[model samples]
Target: MVPEPEFRSYYGQPIIKGPLWHEPHMPAYLYLGGLSGASSLLAAGCELTGRDRLAAPAKIAAAAAGTAGAAFLVAELGRPERFLNMLRVFKTTSPMSVGSWILAAQSGLAAVAAGSALTGLLPSIGKAAGLATGITGPMMATYTAVLVADTAVPSWHTGHRELPFLFAGSALASAGAVAMVAAPHREAGPARRMAMVGAAMETVAGEVLERRLGLLAEPYREGSAGRLMRAARVLTVTGGALAAVSGLTRWRTPSVLSAAALTAGSLCVRFGVLRAGRASAADPKYTVVPQRERIDARERNRAHGR
Candidate 1:
């Protein structure tokens, strides 16, 4: 049998530097952006269905989340102009550039929708703006996943196939939970359904990611990140189940609990992912071992072809 290869790097230093994104800022931005993105979609759907009660909360949530996320992002960037600078040119190849544009569009559109909803003026303009957000909403929610996966971080890069789904699920779950808590129970049926679907999608995608990533997945299941991830799972599952029960009973107690749990769980997912990426980048084994294994596999494939 072939012996297992030892993992190391030059002078025991990390093969790649860990990301500098600090606590509360980057992760908060991620969570809020997801919430905003999905809320925009929910608002648009509710508006089309003439569910004005539900649409009001969703519009407000979308506007608030987007604005807050931008503030956090700006804080992380250390300068307001740094964000504005990104808008100077549209680089199709750069996820950062494209993401900046998406954020701008969604934020502006959501703000307009919320303004119209609140002021009771230009209802037509509000409807048009809310509808426009549907186009940018999904992009806002999942673009961050693509941006991170494009990097060399083992934990983030390896799960590229499933990360987008994970982020999208997280976004929808957060938005649905917000709507469930903010809107009337009768008008919140669709929100409850969305919460369940989103929770299930996030859970399944997370499982698939863990199974596919062998060694790289350790970061997500070990240390501080692991603790957070475990908590997230418990909260998400419980919240999703309770959402169904709440829908059946139409009780305030279960609905509030479910909303709180789902929202917290979504936040945990973002923080845990950032921590996992940092952990993977800090360890040379995460970078080197997978590369060597891929190389060995490629050589074997070539031999078989010959």
Candidate 2:
């Protein structure tokens, strides 16, 4: 066979640049963000349904996760003092900055809601905070899509539209899973329903993104990312079905198993998304060709207008 052409990096160094932060930092951030967002949603649902006992844990978890995740993000920035720089300006084009603000607001609201639950004081204020958190929680759950999409990574940027939905769904399932584990069956009904809804949304969004993202989608369907995402889909679907059916019959074992499955599936989605982004960034073709084509297309359009 003919010898394969040798590939050389600039200055004979590596072509792919790994992320600045360690894997633990990034992966933990993903898990924490999902957990926090889902917890807020669960808390809100519990409050609405008069399940105060369930709301207590959900609120506390949301607050803790939100605050801790924000701390990790600041730490990952490498210079703790420079964290304020993120809030110095508001630019719609900068997803990082916007997401930071969202996270900040979410964390604050969650803290208040949690504190109120713990103190058993200011019930009205707690309700208000819970409502506010419910609004911000969804944004926290899904804005990572916009954050990743804004990057130069091909797989992530291409899947931007669907990523938000995927994250939101995963967050919902994760929160539901936690509630199912902690609350009584009657109190956990809303959690099960939320999990089913989230799972369904995640599966649909992932399928659509995989089908519509063209070549960039390859990363999510061909290697480790593919394996994780496929597993996520299967587990989510199966678990969600069980959750839905559990409502019809009060089978504690099946309900518990389904909740566990949903939690695992949600974690897989986060890991798979991160892996797909890394894979997209590592491939030169993914980074260069699409951008070059876009530039060419823009130039052609300008010339035609002239």
Candidate 3:
């Protein structure tokens, strides 16, 4: 087995700088964006399948979430022009730019869909708008992962492959929570199943990531990030299990509580991811050790002439 890389630093000071995003703004943006994206897709699917009750509420929720998240994003940027400037150029290479475009389309389509539902005007147009959101919604939900993981932050960069799926699951769970709370039990049954599936996917993905990462995963196991992640896991699992039980027993109270837990857990997961990125960037070891190991392995490969 290869030896662990030793990382030296100045009195254990951080090598890389932490993210400058502030609380409630960045995390809230992430949560609401994901929730809106997933809800949009849910609305589209429900409408296509003749679940008008669930579809109507989901469209409204999607519009509200998207509009609120847009506000939070602008607040985080600290200026409206800063966000507006993002639309000046479309770059396929920049996740931020791509996300902006996606959000623009998502928010507009969601609004139109919601408005049509409310005003009973141009019903076919509303259905078309909802269908369009189904395309943009998943992109909005997952691109934030690319935005975060593309940074120099160690935890995020190292976990890039898993982050998108993690965010997708969180989005799905949040959407399910909204559906369960807003729709009738019969209409919400599919949402409960969605919540359970999303929870399982998120939990399993997290486990696989931490297990594969070994030492690099330390930031997720200690400090504030660790605490948030632990809470997310517990809440997500408990909520998912309760939702599953409710489906079997047809109980209303458990379903409601499960929705609340799942919503909270989804938010916690976003916060945990953000904190982990900060923690990883704050520690020099996270920046140095694994990279040094990769360099050492490459050098050894050259020496072997194979």
Candidate 4:
């Protein structure tokens, strides 16, 4: 067998720098932003379906998570003003710019809905605001995936096609879990169903990402990142199964357990994705191999044409 090509960078340094986002804060924000975004949509849907009991909890979850996620994002930036600066200009080419606007609108609408639901003030306005989130809510949930994928991080950039679905599914699971935990059991059937669906989507998309990426997927399937992904998979599958059971039997215990598992699993997915990106960026092999493969493929195509 031909000896494997050795990979190295200048002085063994990485070809590209990893993300500057700090741990806990960035991942926490990701989790919360997703929860808030998806919950807003769920709240609006519940209201339309006349499930006020379920809608109330969804509103509260959306509002609380949105505010908390904003705080975490600000923390990651080390200043709230830094976040506001991004809002000064919106650019179609910039995922961050678009995401900032989406976050602002989703958060504001969620807060208004929660406030109105809690205080019974401006009910009409609150209802309108809640409904409006459906336009921005999905963007809020999956825009982060775009933001990260736009970067040079190999793991994230390579998985762009699936990242949005992964994030969207995770967001749905998180929001649904909260509703399952907070809303009355009988009234939370939609939430349970949503959680199960989200879990299935996340799990399947993740598997596809790993399989399709081949060697590039090593970071996501090894070391701490691998451990976290495995844990997320277990929790998500178990939670989804439990959610289905709880939905049919109306078992409160199973409902609560399912909620806990789904939330934890969603958080794990965010953390694992970030870790995988970091690992891939810190190594030269991941970047070099992909470039070499593309070059080889192009050369082969040219030769064939000749």
Rank by lDDT, highest first: 1, 4, 3, 2
| Cα-lDDT of candidate 1 | 0.94
In model 3, what are the clashing residue pairs, if there are any?
none
Give per-residue CA lDDT, model 4, range 1-306, as digits (tens).
Answer: 999867777887898988988899999999999999999889989989999999999999999999999999999999889999999999999998888999999999899999999999999999999898877788899999999999999999999999999999999998989999899988998999889889999999999999999888999999999999999999999999999989778569998899999999999999999999999999998999899999999999999995
Least accurate stretch of 10 residues (summed lDDT) in model 2? 6-15
Model 3: lDDT of residue 23? 89
User: TM-scores, in order shown?
Assistant: 0.98, 0.85, 0.96, 0.98
Q: Per-residue lDDT tens digits of candidate 1, residues 1-306?
A: 989656657998998878999999999999999999999999999999999999999999999999999999999999999999999999999999999999999999999999999999999999999999988998999999999999999999999998999899889999999999999989999899889999999888888888899999999999999988888888899889989999889578998999999999999999999999999999999999999889999999999994
Q: What is the C-alpha local distance difference test score of each model?
A: 0.94, 0.82, 0.90, 0.92
List residue ranges in candidate 4 displaced over 4 A: none
For this target, which candidate reaches the highest lDDT against the unseen true structure? 1
Residue pair clashes in candidate 1: none
Better of 3 and 4 by lDDT: 4
**Which is the better candidate, 3 or 4, if ranked by TM-score?**
4
Off by over 4 Å in 3: 1-6
As for candidate 4, its clashing pairs are none
Error of 2 at 8 (Å): 11
